[model samples]
Target: MLDASSNRINGSIPLKMGEQGNLNYLNLSNNVMSGIIPNDITLLPNLRLLDLSSNSFHGAVPVTKYSFSPLEIIDLSRNYLNGGIPVEICFIVTLTTLDLSNNSIGGQIPYCLDNLIKLTSLNLAYNNLNGQIPLSLVSLLEMNLLNNSLVAQVPDKYRYCFPAKAFVGNKKLCGNIKGLRHCDLPFFSIIMPLVPMSICIGASLFLYSKRFDQIEGPGIQLLCAFLPR
Candidate 1:
C-alpha cells in the first residue's frame, strides 16, 4: 500500500519496483512522469488498484500474457496512451472500474469485454474507437462512450442508460435518445410491404390467361356455325 499522489515525481517507474512483492495499491497520480508504461507485469501478483492518471505517460497499455494480478480499479485516464484496447483486459474478470478515457487510444472496443461480468463503471470517452456497441453489458452500472468514431444503432442497454452527450461527437451514431440520430430501417424490412402486392399481381395475370384459354375453343365452333353445316 503506497500513496504518492500530488507530488513532483517526474521520472519513469523503475523496473525494480516490482521487487515490492506485497504491494497491493499503487497511487502515482498528478505527477510529471513521462514515458512508455512499464510492461514488466506478472511480477506484481498482488497489485489490485493502479492509478497513474494525470501524467504524461505515452504509449500502449501493458498487457500480460498470463496474469494473477488482482487489478480491479484501473484509472489510466488523462494520458497520451495509444493503441487498441487489449482484449486481455477482459481476462481480468475481477475488474470493476476501468477508466481509460481522454487518451489517444484507437480501434474497436473488444466485443469480448462483455465477458467482464463484474465490471460496473467504464469510461472510454474521447478515444478513437469505432464500431457498434455490444448488445449486452449486463453488469455495467455506469458507462461513458462519448466522442469516438463509433457507428450503428445504440444498443438498448445503453440507449437510455447514458445521456446524449455521452454519445455526442460521434459521426454515425444513432439511438432513441433525444437529439440523437435515429436508426434507418433495414432494407429487408423496407421491401417486405411490397411482397403481397407482387403476389396479387401474379395471381391476376394467371387467371386472365386461364380465362382466355377457356374461351378460345368456342371461336372455331362459331366460325363453323356461320359456314354451311
Candidate 2:
C-alpha cells in the first residue's frame, strides 16, 4: 500500500511504476500532477484500489486490453480528461466502484456494463456523456448520473431506489421522478385526437341521412352532399 496523496507530485507518472508487481494499493489524489494518466500504471496486476482524483490529468483514460489489473476500486474523477470511455473498461471484471465524474468525457455510456458484474457504485455526473443509460446499469445499487445528455425512461423498479438527483441535469430524461417531467408521446398526442373526431363526424352524417330517408327531392340532394361522392 502506498499513500502519496495530498502531495506536490507533478509531471507524468513514471512508466517504471508498472515494475512494482506486488504493490496492492495506491493513492495519489489531491495532487498537483498533470499529464495523461500513465498507461503503465494500469499494468499493475495486483493493485486493488487506485485514487488519482483531484489532479490535472487530461486526455483520454488509457484503459486497454493490455491492462491485466485486478483493481476493484478505480477513481479518476475531478480531472480534465476528455474522450469517450474506453469499452475495454468492461474487461476489468473485478471492478466494484468506478468514479469518472466531473470530467469532459463525451459519447454514450458503454452498453456492456453487464460485464462488470460486481460493480455496485458508479458516478458519471458532470460530464458530456450522451445517450440512453444502459439497461444493464439499472441493476447497480448506487449511481450518480446527474448533468449529462442521457436520454432514457427510468424504469419503474429504479424510481424509488434511485432518486431525482441521479438524473436531474438531463433534459431528455423522463419518468416518474420528482424533478423530471413525464416522457412525452407526441405520436399518441397528435394522432389519438383525430381518430375519435373522424368517427363522430361520420356517425353524424349517417344519422342525418337516416332521418331524411323518407323526404323527397331537396332532402335527398342535401343528404347526398353530406355523404361521400
**Top TM-score model:** 2
Report the lDDT tens digits of candidate 2 across residue range 1-229: 8999998888877778879989899999999998888887778989999999999999998788788799899999999999999998998999999999999999999998789999999999999999888877878999999999987677776676786799999987888898987875433233333343335333332122222233233322333344443
- Work out the TM-score per prediction: 0.80, 0.82
- At residue 71, candidate 2 shows an lDDT of 88
- In order, how many clashes per candidate? 0, 0
Worst 10 residues of 2 by lDDT: 204-213
C-alpha lDDT of residue 198 in model 1: 28
Q: What is the lDDT of residue 200 in candidate 1?
A: 36
User: Which residue runs of candidate 2 sit more than 4 Å off their true CA positions?
Assistant: 193-229
Q: Number of clashes in model 1?
A: 0
